[model samples]
Target: MQACGLDFGTSNTAAALPDGTVLPIAPDTAEPRLFRSVLFFPEDERTTYAGAPAITRYLEDNAGRFIQSVKSFLHSRSFRATQVHGRTWTIEELVAVLLRRVREAAGAQTGAPPEAVILGRPAVFSPEPEADALAEQRLRKAAELAGFTHIQFLIEPIAAALAYEAQLSREELVLVADFGAGTTDLTLMRLGPSRRGRPDRKADVVGSTGVRIGGDRFDAELMRHKLLPRFGAGTTYRVRGLSDKRLPVPQHVMAKLLSWHEMSFIREKSTQELLQLMLESSDKPETAEALYDLVMENLGYRLFRTIEATKVQLSREEEATLDFEEARISLHERITRAEFESFCQPLLTELEQCTQGLLERCAGAGEIDAVFLTGGSSQIPAVRKLYVDRFGEARVRTADAFTSVAEGLGRACVSLVSPDLINS
Candidate 1:
């Protein structure tokens, strides 16, 4: 059976073939492997664009609605449906569109649609059991709608472990840490060359745990601390009734701006009216004007992309500068690695607690031979320090930060269909 593994991540997506080849899907963009998980709907046209084209169209023309991180809304009860270009779309319907694109690209490469697929999913979709169940159901529905006849799921971290295990020649205990745009997942499993062909290896998994905090949270922290303040986040304005009395601008508006999925809500007429009222009563009229222009011109995504790029740059250097000038919002600031680490301290603490909990659950299962890290956020210096501080630096192994899970999932597909092929 021809099959593939799909990693439909929060910020990006990737696919792999059963033979361990990373599928090249994005023919439309320069970055062939990393497909942006974004969609753009033009107001006057019936056509929709995904991946790089979607981002390009959104940046070039402000008339269309740009939706990103659609995977994040799988479990959102409040996000039942949204209207785009006069058509109502449920979250599943939008996700199905993305899935279909991926399937089409993979089919084009292989001359046929995959007969079956191994889909990478988070270990825990939500903290609540019912919500998690609903999230899985929605994902399954989206996969079915995308034209897959058979689908199987593998916990994301576990799949990464499988990819790492393929390099092992002897039995070893491994702990896999996968940090993505939306979540951080950890898994402890026993792996070796011998276990590669096993049909029933459930017992090999010792423990697994996850927390809903990752790259997006860091980007939001950057926005809240550095960017938003320049755009009237904490500035004050006088009450219309009393000239002497002043109240701080509503922080909730800034909160929405920091959020990736909720920024679109600020474009509504009611919010704009409220912003205009706040602008009139503001002590700093210029800041208010910039804030008003920001939402009015629909520049939230562009700002976010700038913030995200800064974060990525900080991961590689000791210092990075954020300079955003668009829609009459001009701001430039220099950020040091120390400051970025300080901003993300609380989240790092949560990640430590989550990993410790998983360790406790896997207690008495001999020493962990190696700790494997994957995902884009894993490249962050502070994030890497978390695992290195716990398990010595020498014990940690890293590979293909973004595509490891998808590659592992593809390996899992081979094991499912032709166990002998994997062994060979």
Candidate 2:
């Protein structure tokens, strides 16, 4: 196989060849073209698994370390490493494990392992310049670790723009919106048959902007507003001292519960002891104990899976039930579109600010010929309304009738790709 375009997304990953055709990397999953971004390490089992088998293995045995949303932590300064079965794995190393899996799958598709890749990335991984640069550097290191001799990057929204432009018959100035699990990127660029194969697209690119908020943040919001109360997010606890003074549970405990990826880390002895103390001094002992049980049993992912299902259902229905049952905890909540939208109002506002910042670099909303939407979160009616309200319903549309970032990256890679830029 030749150098391919790889979209290693937060929630899912996809790769495409130079011919603008996406590779069905995850043939085992329901969506063959899209591989879920998950990794599982079974207890006492040195064997690791990625993609569909990883999820399956983790779900079946429920005894291993299940990791997701790995891409979301790339830019963090505090997140240095994670201990996986006693060996500490850095962020880049963990990412390399997933990238290596993607490379092998691409190799399987064409019988030639690709060592060159053009990776798709958000327009801004971090607003801070140092962090953003570090994020890109870490990604390149991960690609190198995955055995890619030549690796490059394209802004995700621009890649989507290329895919949109490939199908356009006439020239037009358009705004491409590429939403992923961890970020939403927007690009205003010139596109169409007239400029399809340009080697240098920087001049044609008018502006780009992105936010670190996307579907994952929406999931966190759903968990925070709808589910955290059941786990004692807002409840107060009594002091163990003789004084009758009551204290609220520290917000950090709830924050850990909100983050499924870090939930396992909180099971240290110190945390467990703290939970015991909180359980002993709580006004609502049941909720506090439930919180303790959630951590001890490592049920964060299972609970968040229900949260994800609920969000998906609300995208199509007016209401969805967020339901989950563990040995000791039962969550059953019905939420309407209006209520969920209200919960996500703050996130939607941030998105507006993000897009408004991008539009400031252009003439106006009317100057945009089309608005291309990508990613699963774009299907949310409330999110779609944001663009439609600004740029009329007729002007807004999906990119290539699917998430087109990987396809667009593939098109971008068709321009004289090298197996090894350093050697060749």
Query: lDDT of all the models against the reference?
Result: 0.86, 0.85
Question: What digit string (tens of lDDT, one per residue) describes model 2 on residues 1-424?
Answer: 3688899999888898877889989886788898888899999689988888988888788787888988888999898798888889898988898999988898899786687888988999999999998889999999999998888899998989988888899988898887778899999998889788877788889999999888888999998888888888778876666578877888888898776877887898987877887788877888887888889888888887888889989999999888788867888899999999999999999898888878886755347888888888898888889999999999997954344999998888875364333111
lDDT of 2: 0.85
Clashing pairs for predicted structure model 2, backbone only: none
Each prediction's RMSD over C-alphas, in Å, is 2.0, 2.3
Candidate 1, backbone clash total:
0
Which candidate leads the pack in lDDT? 1
Instruction: Kindly list the per-residue Cα lDDT of model 1 for residues 317-409, writing each as its tens digit.
Output: 999999989877898899998998998899999999999998988799999999999999999999999989989999999999988998888
Error of 2 at 77 (Å): 2.4
How many clashing residue pairs appear in each of the predictions shown?
0, 0
User: Where is model 1 more than 4 Å wrong at Cα?
Assistant: 241-245, 417-424
